[model samples]
Target: MPWSDHAIWWHVYPLGFLGAEPAALPPDSAPRHRLPVLADWLDHLVGLGCNGLALGPVFASETHGYDTVDHFRVDPRLGTEDDLVRLVEEARSRGVHVLLDGVFNHVGRSFAPFADVVRHGSASSYADWFVPEGDDFRTFEGHGHLVALDHASPAVVDHVTDVMDHWLARGVSGWRLDAAYAVPQAFWRTVSDRVRARHPEAWLCGEVIHGDYTSYVTEGGLDSVTQYELWKAIWSSLNDVNPHELAWSLTRHSALLDVFAPQTFVGNHDVTRIASRLREPRHLAHALTVLFTVGGVPSVYAGDERGRQGVKEERVGGDDAIRPAFPDSPSGLGPEGLDVQRLHQTLIGVRRRHPWLVRARPRPHTVDDTVLAYTLHDPDSGAAVAVALNYGGEAATATVPAAAWEPAAGDATPAAGDGSVSLPPYGWCVATAPTLPS
Candidate 1:
């Protein structure tokens, strides 16, 4: 089967979410067996209406689960392969798909093959597996600890293909290819084709920060790519008080739908928390309104719905703040957290009820520095939903086309005697009209 058209994703950075040590401990250190901790949150995810769990790096690694040391083994810090088996089985039982992070672009300095190259130098049989720069090997973006793999090498290709097959057999629904933009597009086509040959239902999404996303999905054989361009526009536009910026990005976002849907989100493991990034916390609802109502499969970063705050920085240990551990259950949440969680549940309900929003195109009615009004419609069914937002301190009104006007979601209500709606400061609304007969 193809991926569910209405997949609602909940992303978690496992190592950080479970509070694993920042650095890898010695081999003799007792295993933490933290994989089961996530099992405790499966119900929480289901309660939030999420159908997919997008886990960050979880394989054996030197640190942070990114510089992978072994593809076949689960990180000792997390647990044994049995733990992964149990987690996947549990998630599946709850009707949630699990997407593993595939860090194919590089390996930890300690990866056995790379270790052999380090020890034997030119005589190592694996010397050809990595990019050689004079007497040294190339690293991922200058991080000496993250050694880049040579995609040109047949051995590397086979290894990656084997890793993917191994996990898919263990019940992983798909892969979220890490740093995929850094790898050659042809390599992905080869890998994707190989994997799909055996498991045609598998879903493959890439971590593409910048570039033509259309090419990555259509030409590179990926099902989707991270929508970072739209991500940046969401927060930046709100901070700069420029709704037109969001309008332009949405226009581009609509064009991308003509090719394939991108993976959409407001906050993720790699960036600062949305609450911390926005100038005013109230604007959070407006940002989320656009995320869910716009086209694409959407993901909620772990803890974002709880109003978590963290700022990502470039210095050592900078990521620790954003990737903090979560308590094992919902009862642990504070009062404000419970409120945020309720908001997420309600908003996600709106998306789930209108799965066609996945392919709906945005039709803008108004755009200004602090106000935006648009409608998302299913062309084939004539089903439509109107969205209005006001980011300024005072309330604002937006006129909706008579045919598009309908019952609004949240606090928004119809304006008597006018085809318009009123929005409070930092407020937004989602309204749906009856489908016009085709």
Candidate 2:
């Protein structure tokens, strides 16, 4: 828990980022020792100011990582279990914490238990491990290749619990439960309670898009959940030139902060890259300004710091564009990529200085179609940072609450004697302020 408070994760989707084969390799094929390749990038990750490496599925799977086959074994495409130990050891040496993706809601058709059910029907010892429909079984979100797990089964619960404990004992810091919204809250509570009894420091974050997030954390006994509402609002509002939407989302975000620190992000592996999502390229900075300044456990999707651009569509290989492989090292990157990296470093520096922003409440001072200004204030400490964003074509200004304000980051000018902060077109700012009076 102490380590997570200072975590700024660099999330990477290993299958795509490491250029592994698109589908499962034959059982007899040679293993690929690619996990250590990620180890080589630790310097780049740490240099980027991120203290956590949040990795996508490294477990054996049928296709993409979400369709998990064997939860206990490291995918041969990623190498053996020993490869993972080395990666964890390397990360530990550099003070980087690793969080693995756990796909518990469903399993690939090839999962041993599911395969047994297919061959032996109800007579299979693993028959109760899945949800059956007549001779067939339930699929996840209509994806036939993905078989939904029967959470009600005690065997299934024990399997998931064991898998979590197995990896936690191996040195990973925590887990990110994939498709957790589809699973029952009580089921998570049962499994989490048992896991926590041993590894209380293991952070459990659910992948919840919508519904009662506060309930998911408290009732489900989870440490956190993804802030998808804010992620969508950040891009949608910027594209529509509607800061009011973002303001509303921020209000909801502050409420969640009362319960737990949601995992906040702009560009992740699932969606189009932030660089491509914004209609006006300059608004990219506006999106990130909200990500780092607002309260949450923030993450920088790999390649986003380099201004990577990729659009996700609803087709077979839509995700490929967003999850492209990286070069061997940071030195191989070009000038343009390095420029964006510098901007991220500047913003992250501001965040590192004001760590309390993880739970600071945003008090809206100005909200309009194209402009938003608010103070991220921690009432307990009387600490605050004023953030102003302008999406209009010309210059814009907004008043912030503070006795005095000095520029912290971004292109906005410093606040004046009257507490007014001004910004050029598509500009933003993060500035520190004197403690506010009660």
Candidate 3:
């Protein structure tokens, strides 16, 4: 039942491999200029039981791999198509899938089309490829160096489709469109339409940070987006243990359930490490519980289980604290990688065992007490799971419908009252039981 609920949002930093980063470049910056250890990284991802891995831009970008120069070629540093193909092949045999970052909103200044526009002053054949107002082309995020493409134009349309077509055939699962807030929704609809027509199983998840993701799920646009506003608020409030702050995320996200599945996640490369939230082992356990039992796939950022909270800011500046070299062992990881790895395996395995989690619908519930519980059901499997978390030092109890999961579970203790149960300190427990399909 909760299996449908688990997903780990993986945020990777190229600096972990390049061993160098440019100050302020975003996490997932392509190591193209300083190619990282491709085989090694892929191997690590496979070991983690990742069903789907969302990769950042791997094209030749000037900084952070966001300033993409070419949409067609895989950056040389990341390796050739064969390496990618090989990685995909290896992962498939192991049951893992891959997603690449598609930063189409902007391109590097040195991009051929942009270069033409710069040299020809709009008279060039590629002149109209970018956004134009009178005589000037619009820049992305106000960086004068990047040129935003005019997605409505015919030639640009053809070029983008061609590139997307190539990637779909390359054995990748889908794309994570960057800065989708800026890109025209119409273009995305066309992109998604064409992509789905070619590969029906290909799922496109866009980056929609502040608003409703459903508005963007149009023709060729996207299947889903990073539902950040709600989660970010929840993350902040929950971090402070402020009861009043907790309801906002649940209520707001609950409202949007009809539109898209919450791409439920905890930490990414951009934020402070998840360990920062794990003040106690139970705190970390609770976060992982929500991460896995919520109605979505749980994403895992590298080095999180090892208790990585980042290290001293390095030269290639970023949230350098987050980009610390992923420790090989927990010693390499301050918490050590080995211990973290074990924790992840246990949690991820639970998610994998219950396919319903990857497939269920969840209902959120909160009470006067200091705990939050959600009910998830898989219509196809008739399995129901309830996950509860008590953030307080002492134990807390919650009442559930008679229809909630039954206590065939060894972890569940009998309630002091009629049938309700109390969960242990800083603890989260998952109860999965069979039911008849509605």
Best by TM-score: 2
Ranking by lDDT, best first? 2, 1, 3
Model 3 gets an lDDT of: 0.64
lDDT per residue, candidate 2, 121-179, as tens digits? 88999989998777678889989888999999999999999999999999999999999
Model 1 residue 48 distance off true place after TM-score fit, in angstroms? 0.6
lDDT values for all models:
0.87, 0.90, 0.64
Per-residue error (Å), model 2, residue 123: 2.0
Q: Candidate 1 on 1-438: residue-level lDDT in tens? A: 146567889999999988888778797877789999888898989999999999998898988888999999888888889999999999999999999999999999999999999899879999889988876789899898899999998888889899999999999999999999999998999899999998788889999999889888777899999999999999999888789999999999999988888899999998999999999888888888888899898999999989899999999888989999877776676676777788888888888878888877798887876788888777766777888888788888886666645554666854535548788877787888765323
Model 2 per-residue lDDT at 385: 87
Better candidate number, 1 or 3, judged by TM-score: 1
- Clash-forming residue pairs, model 1: none
RMSD of each: 1.6, 1.2, 4.7
Candidate 3: regions farther than 4 A off: 1-11, 18-36, 41-47, 132-136, 243-248, 277-281, 311-316, 327-339, 364-366, 402-417, 436-438
Worst 10 residues of 1 by lDDT: 410-419
lDDT of 3 by residue, 1-438 (tens): 222233344556554534544533454654343432433555566566665556666665665677787777656655556656776676556556777778788888878788888798768999778877666678887777777888888787778777777887988777778888887788888877777788877767777777556788744357677767645655555566653455556566655555556566677666667777545554676666656655554577766756667533435465667765543332333334576677677667666667556535556554444666666777766777766666677877754444545543224533423335577765556666576324
**Candidate 2 — which residues are off by over 4 angstroms?**
none
Candidate 3's error at 352, in angstroms?
1.9
Q: Best candidate, lDDT-wise?
A: 2
Kindly give the stretch of ten consecutive residues in candidate 2 with the minimal lDDT sum.
412-421
